[model samples]
Target chain A: MKSRVWLRWFVVTIGLAAVIHVAVVWLVPVVIMRVFMSRVAAQYGVNRVITQPLPTDLSRTVVKPSPDLLYGVCVFDVSAGPVRLSIMPPTTYWSLSLFDTNTDNFFTFNANDLKVSTADLMLGSAGDSGDAAARFPSARFVVTPHNKGVMLARLLVLDKTNMDEALAAQKSIQCNAIKRGS
Target chain B: MMTWVAKAIGVLVVAAAIAIGSAWAVLLHYPLQTDIANGSWRTSLAVGSTSADPYTRARVALTGLFALNPSEAIYFSANVDNAGRPLRTHCTYVIDGKPFVAQWWSITAYADDNFLIPNPANRFSFNMGNVPTGTDGRYRIVASSAEQTGNWLPTGTGGRGLILTLRLYNASPEILRQLSSIELPSIKLAGSCP
Candidate 1:
């Protein structure tokens, strides 16, 4: 009888471990993403891009930020409708990527992603009104997996002396809400 | 009975232990790591993509939130040398890099805290845009706490261990499709690593 009881306890431990693994694994990303999104929204507001100050040395809250690169961020919300993004491609290296609420990068556009010097994109969810996406050429339409997330834009600063110029170029990039058929 | 109460507490303690222990283990070891250049350098196969596994997403969220997938940019990090030893702050290293099919590339060093190491030199990274190549178009970067002449990346005077991050932006699809077959840089131990 004692042996049977030990066997049951062992099985119970293994089963509970598996359950815990799945729960934490699935929940951490969601919770972290939500907290991050809330912070960005509070700091920059929604549907806008805020170019952060260059990461100071020995000061980084984000993971392993590249010191040579200048990063700008926008928290996107597509619940009301699609959002429009316009960027003047820098002469130097630059890229823009969109991440869904689940922290998955659904769409990414880089300096190479641009055949033109300037890129205009309309991003929305599949559930959003089709007319909002129709304003832009179909080729420039990107659909997110969810209505809320982040858009991260990175511009490489080649010379430390020319950082101000790079920030000016980064400021030229525009983001705004999309109004359908207006 | 007193025995029954003790058994119930035991079960709860066991469950809590399992939950926290497994979470920590997954956080430390669950991300997919692909070795490059004889395991001297490595990158994640799951970063910045929709298809990343749950553990990878969790780990990335904790460590690196904005990591681009291999296609946009492939980031390789190294803490070991060509002979497979931990890189110490006191030790100097020779990074022999190959010309890649990328439009732009760079190598930056970060301390153990994942922040740029504060050095009096104010030199944190070496990129194609800034560093000058040898007459033959080949380049070499020195990783040391002491000052070196060309392509010097200071690991800081504090002499803490550091990680080197190599970014290849706009890499050709062929390279990403077959990372193992291609040639990456080598970080070999220079002098003594005591």
Candidate 2:
């Protein structure tokens, strides 16, 4: 009887452990992204760009940041449909990346990826390409499995003298709801 | 009745211990980190991968969002010198780097808290685009509190206890396939300390 009881305990213990580990690993990304998006949304209304200067101290809400890089963020929501993003990179090293709530960068494009001054792309949840995709054949398409996430544009601010210039350039980038003319 | 209750409690105890303990070690510090290029750099191959285990997935999701898979980018971090001593701000470091095959690469300095250390120079990183090369096509970056000519990266005030993050973006096929065999940068302590 005691041997049977021990076997049962061992099996239960192993099973419970596996469940917890898998659950935490799978859910941590979604949970963290939700908090980040909510905070960004609260600070700057949804679908709008929030351009932030280089971090000066550890007091800022951003975690583990590189202070020399100017950042522009948008908490994207494609539940309504596809979102249209327009970027004009200043004459410097720059990259724009799209992250799903799961924390995977499904799509990343750099200045080298585009030759034009004005770059446009369609960001959407996994599904149809939508009419915006047809309109912007030249524009890239980024599809995320998750409905809501973040789009971050990072520009390398070589020095302090260019802060104002970086800000001006950041102001011109746009992440807006797609209004396709069908 | 008492005997059964005792066994049930034991099972719960063991389960919680195993679940939380493994998660803490794996997701927190990346205990499974791989050392490459004669142990000069360290990275986790599983990070940002679709096939990453649960622990690695959670760790990357928590620490770095929007990280590329290894095929697109690979990140290596080092906190100690080649001599196996903890990097300190009081001492200067010479980062002699040979360009790993990549479309572009960069090395950025972060404080103990993982934020950019603020300094008067406003310099934070050196990359392939801006870093000046040497006579032999290699680059030597001096990370010091005092400014130096050529390629200089400020450690800021109290920047001694810093972490260096090396990022290779759009890495070449040889690097992505055989990272361990290739030679990377080496970090050495420079000058005598007070």
Candidate 3:
């Protein structure tokens, strides 16, 4: 009788341990994957890559972001004005590229046709007022209106390296048109 | 006496089986494989190579109010054929059943490298919103640079790499589950551009 009870107890303990091990090794990864996927979905701001239709409307003035998000983007109305880009300190490999709304072509960035020196950019706009000043080097360029609308403004944060600063800088990138007859 | 012990063991075994099975199903089901059309795209979609790992691929039936996230959908390069000529483009697709209240769906063609083809017509995509459909509600999307109309997705003028993305929105759950049953579009190169 005693041996039988000990054997039953051993089997129960072994089975429970196996269950816990599986939970830790298998279930935990699954849960983490789900959480990661959700975060990616929110971060990329793309609805469904393979299976869904894209929304036509681009009217939202700002990218509404989640707390853990690494990037925020919005496809603005081209008539809105020259896109103002802002970069906060200490974060690396961040950029905002503009595309032809209909054709998705590279337009320009940072007040230049290409990505110019961030240092030279600072030199050009030195002592300008935060408001009404050229935000990027390309600010000097003309905003010629096109018949088709621009599609999206992509703000990429490499490695989510400085996620906190990225989130804040995301808010700082602003856009407005050149004043009428200015 | 033995029967009671056997019944108890059976119950425990069945319970364990259920738990393990459910866990396995959840972990293994989605995203089976992704085939990179290899050199089919002409330009590079990314900064580096054509193939990428940890990529996201989906199987969707573009029927009702479905949408794509433009950010994640990277473009591939458009390549020309081996003979130094533009590729002839011909293609067709089928939608097995009817969709109710389909606002619009589209198949945008991209070069293997993920850039829009340079074309005079400024056409790059085909959509149900503008293309014609059969009376039975079936649809075919054609990709070519040859300037065909009615569901012609403009391929880059050169015939090389091609990637077709079909977008569907607001699809019913029934269609989602039956994705395996849906047929993919077919392509046959008829001739090349001069």
Which number leads on lDDT?
1
lDDT, model 1, position B142: 93
- Better candidate number, 2 or 3, judged by lDDT: 2
How many clashing pairs does model 1 include?
A: 0
The most accurate candidate by TM-score is: 1
lDDT of 2 at A69: 66
Candidate 3, Cα interface RMSD? 17.3
Q: After superposing candidate 1 on the true structure, give the runs of residues whose Cα lies further than 4 Å from its correct spot.
A: A127-129, A133-139, A160-165, A179-182, B1-6, B29-37
Question: What digit string (tens of lDDT, one per residue) describes model 2 on residues A149-175?
Answer: 788887766665666777777887789
Ranking by DockQ: 1, 2, 3
The complex in candidate 2 yields a DockQ of: 0.42
Where is model 3 chain B poorest over a 10-residue stretch in terms of lDDT? B57-66
TM-score of the candidate numbered 3?
0.32
Model 1: fraction of the reference interface contacts it also forms: 0.62
Q: Candidate 2: which stretches are off by over 4 Å?
A: A1-11, A125-130, A134-138, A159-166, A179-182, B1-14, B30-38, B44-46, B49-52, B84-92, B99-104, B118-123, B128-138, B142-162, B172-178, B189-194
lDDT of 3 by residue, B51-121 (tens): 22111211111010011222222222222333323333332222122333322334555554434455666
What would the per-residue lDDT of candidate 1 be over residues B56-137, giving only the tens digit for each residue? 7887687667788777888777778889787777789998876778878888888866778877788888887787778777
Please identify model 3 stretches exceeding 4 Å from their true place.
A1-72, A75-182, B1-103, B188-194
Question: What DockQ was computed for model 3?
Answer: 0.04
